[model samples]
Target: MVGSGQLRLLAGTLCAYERDGLAYELQQALVYVDDLLVVGNSMKGINCLKSLLDKEFNIKDLGELRYFLGMEVARAAQGINICQRKYALNLIKDTIFLGAKPYSNPMDSNAKLYEKCGTVFKGPSKYSRIVGRLIHLTHTRPDIVYSVSHLSQFLANPTNLHYQVALRIVKYLKNEPGKGLFYPSQNNTKVKGFSDFDFDWGSDLDTRRSITGLCFSLVTPSFHGRVRDKKQSQGPQQKQNIAL
Candidate 1:
């Protein structure tokens, strides 16, 4: 035989093995600390790999993948649906806006957020903590991303108005704690992108700088940005090379 007892490189966040040239068509074992998730296209191959792991180590077979890293997994004929309802509920419970009424929109269209106009928050640490948790919640809830990005601007010196808007975002979260993006398990998922920018929306009283909001989304990393600039002319012509 090759060896009597040969166990090598059995600890890692991700593990993959392939004897043939095909790598992506084979099995995959993803591990987060102690939680191990074995997955593959074919159920027969998956079970065989899992059995080897269980025999070598003492890993308990949880069978199917349901929940991992705050996201719930539900398998079906159409496709797999993922959500973070439990995580979102727990997040609401941990915050001060649990009992608050829900709202339809994450942000107020009439509300214009000026940086240095409102009264300063006495407890900025609390505001920062809430914003941090909200950022984590955005992992599954992209709907609140605009609101969270808006609130994050005032982290250095958050005002009462900013804090209120942050609470409003939490209230938005209360609308549907189970609401999350559905990622259909299929080949050929199309990618789409759109960008928008504002032209000197509001001018700061002290600095004379204007506010600009820019947003763009890629396949994975979707982000929005707020820029303070004095140049107001030809804002749209700046990025003419960007395709879409």
Candidate 2:
């Protein structure tokens, strides 16, 4: 029984123990940030563990677990459904992207963003900071992962064109603030991955490297994926796959 910093490690240890059949009384336990949830077959067993935790740390009994880390958990006879709709909505509101129109895709396929020779940056740092925030938002918004990654290459010395592209992404977010990841009750449970590369994508620059892209998806459990790109040709190739 643990809380706070030790809670996650203890949960892992308990899970391993349960998997090894070392414990029968402890049924299920979940840890998120500073919160801990322990469910056992008998009330006596749960109370015993709770008492131990209370002695060790200042513990709060939350009873049944409904939400953790912004994820809503609902338990039923069929299965458990987890969603972050509220979190997603809040994020959109925080970013002020709620009222914007939603686009069917993350980025435009026809747009070509690149730095040209003799192009002077009016304010590189400010543009870079905005792009950086957009990149972080891609963690939950996979749709924009490729676009954000593609735009990140010019972070060090972003040009005016780069800033325009980043602004477009922000505008897109404004259009579809409510959109987010959805985990259905039924999905395929297969792990599939895709990889691609673009040759001489950064031909405009002195660094002559192609961009590489990779994506991994679990057809079942949860249908979520991430897309990452390099600085050169390989990066745009990855973005293309993500857009598809």
Q: Best by lDDT, which number?
A: 1
* lDDT of every predicted structure (CA atoms): 0.64, 0.56
Which candidate wins on TM-score?
Answer: 1
TM-score of candidate 2 against the unseen true structure = 0.57
| Residue 197 in candidate 2, Cα distance off native in Å | 3.0
TM-score for each prediction? 0.68, 0.57
Off by over 4 Å in 1: 1-13, 19-23, 26-28, 40-45, 48-52, 55-57, 97-99, 185-187, 199-244
Per-residue lDDT tens digits of candidate 1, residues 55-135? 666566655666677766656564555567777778778775576888888898777776785899999999999898889
lDDT of 1: 0.64
RMSD (Å) of each candidate, 1 decimal: 14.5, 12.2
